[model samples]
Target chain A: MYGNSQFDGSAAFSGGGFMPSQAIPTADPSSPAKSREAQGLLPLTVKQIREVFQASDDKANFLIDGVSVNNVKLVGLLFEKTERVTDVSFVLDDGTGRIDCHRWVQESLDTKEMELLSNGTYIKVHGHLKGFQGVKQLVVYSVRRITDYNEIPNHVAECIYVHCYNTRTRKMQDAPQATGQLPNPAVNTPSKGYQPTSSNHSQFSVQPIVDGMKGIDKIVLNYIEQPSCIGKENGIHRAELAKQLNVPEHKIMEAISSLESEGLIYATVDEFHFKSTVNG
Target chain B: MDTSNPAAFVNAELLRMYVGRRVRAVIQVLRNDGGSIFGKSTDEQELVVKGHPPNPPTTFVEVIGIADSNRSIQAEIWTNFGDNFDVSSYNTICQLANGDFKHLFI
Candidate 1:
């Protein structure tokens, strides 16, 4: 019963009428046909993409192959509120020389894939095509962050290479390749002992150089409630300090540097000690 | 800038009150050689006029408390008629105030 030539990629059941095999027979008989279909679908590499387009009918589906996709949009929903997946949407670029994508849902999304979707995170998606709002798009059923060779399968690795190469070419076109040369000053002599810092510091002090500097008054007032942070013992690193105050690191550093220069605080390599009025 | 008009008088005082509360108000500076004047208040609050002018000029106007169906407090200002004014200046001053004070001036 097993060695029949008629089983050419299609399954014929024992029933008299032939049921066109909906999916490839796996070792487990209970697996859903949709899952099998998802596994069978091939992953498209980024290099193969020329453009992406939004499906007109289903705002969620995107057409990548230059053909109009009339289907539902693919969306992944997560129940757990995780930082990585919140407030993120992905656009799938099919290798067709366009940017075709769809906005699937209004509610916030959370998923494992979102963690890898951060800036500079690379990932691969495996999903089935679904039509939403008259557009055909991939609904990711499974996704994995791309890592070095050992982690990814061979086929997936090839796809990643193709994608990376295409992305590099596109980036090059956007920014001209630099020739890396020094400016020529054959006629004019280089200026000697030009101290630009004095003038620069004056202007910097007059205006708030940092984008999101919290006012010194506000900081002093708010610090009262958090008494544990009273002294230099609780001094946080520049990055951590910025995050706590919801300001940029450079701004915090600038504020500290200014206060230190003014003799208001004692500055060391890593921390600044707020001067106690009682000492005076 | 006709300070003679009662509406102009009320608006000028309201502007001072707004600024005292750190709220900004926009007023059109109209000059017909005499003085600058304003008409119409941005907010609606009752004016409690007390004491005559020029005798140390102490006037206190309380913003009448009127709660609407939505539970939002309404402020109304009262002024006598006949003052020529501009509305655009008041709108600008409201914007200059922080986002929190916009409703107060508005």
Candidate 2:
């Protein structure tokens, strides 16, 4: 039996489906490698593809407006088609810009798909972004001629929506969460170099409750744990907490109730105000 | 030869600014007279495309060429988009590509 194996025989474990917050790893889940693996195909324009910048010291980690992008879906006019012995290369022009794209000749099906496309054919390509000699290009996974004319406009709309989400909307939503994550046990210890003994003591006391909480609950707890909230005897008001989190009052109420049930927070002054049990 | 300058996506109105420059527009062919095409732009404005029109004109065609005037284009390329094209969606893209998101394009 492979009972002792790391992968084991957990046939029921659905990797792509929902998992409870507690089961999810609490560490920096958005590590560049992990986030890249989790990011699905980003619908992007040829201009955005050309504009992607190397985000980290590692040359391979590319980002479009701070959003990690790996696989991408593009719709454009196939301008030039060339067939080499092992790969088919073409240039795609989407009106915004043009970029070189290539697909490997792996099978008869690939060659057949390549044969269907010619110069000036509108096509949809799903591919990975790659850099060769400082020039960005696509290593295509699948290419299909766009039979439906609506797909062109649809692709444009999709790319704009994705662009806004990556550059503006998602960043606004993630700002508080990024600050909230600084107090994580894994990240807190090293930063408290001057007071290691006190940091370790607090870490041990807070680790269990912090480990089980996530998302809005973790954010609410972190806000309550702030020195300003903890120093006051009345704690912070529910309205203030809701405003700080930019979430609906009902959602804050739900998170507060869940945290209270777990004994991580306690009412102070009145039921309207709450403080973290560990630090307050 | 003209590959150095990218063809900007333009509507009947946007075409005015790019006079004598490369532009692309999808137009619903209203009439074809062999050497020229009289069509309606995605924005529903009339446009004259001077080039060899498609032998059997489709409902819609995308023309890429130099904007000769405010209402006319000297087409260098014509792509036959089959019948049943969505004009409204293309209209929205034209406005977005030239307006708020102009920086995204060349």
- Measured by TM-score, the strongest candidate is 2
Overall local distance difference test of candidate 1: 0.31
Q: Report fnat for all candidates as fractions from 0 to 1.
A: 0.00, 0.47
The total of clashing pairs for model 2 equals: 0
Candidate 2, TM-score vs. the true structure? Answer: 0.65
lDDT of 2 by residue, B1-100 (tens): 1135677888898999999999999999999999999999988999999999878989999999999999999998888888899888888888898888
Instruction: Report the alpha-carbon TM-score of model 1 versus the true structure.
Output: 0.20
A-chain TM-score of every model: 0.25, 0.52
Candidate 1: tens digits of C-alpha lDDT, residues A58-132: 342333332222221211112122242224345532211112232223243434345445422324455444445
Every candidate's chain B TM-score: 0.25, 0.93
The TM-score of candidate 2's chain A against the true chain A comes to 0.52
For candidate 2, write residues A1-280 as lDDT tens digits: 7877677444455342432221222344544234323335668877777777876544346777665666778888897799998999998887777889889998999999999988988899988777766777888869999998888778877777656645553444443221111111222232221111222344443543465576899899889978888788888999999998898999999999987766667799899999876562
Docking quality level of the chain pair in candidate 1: incorrect
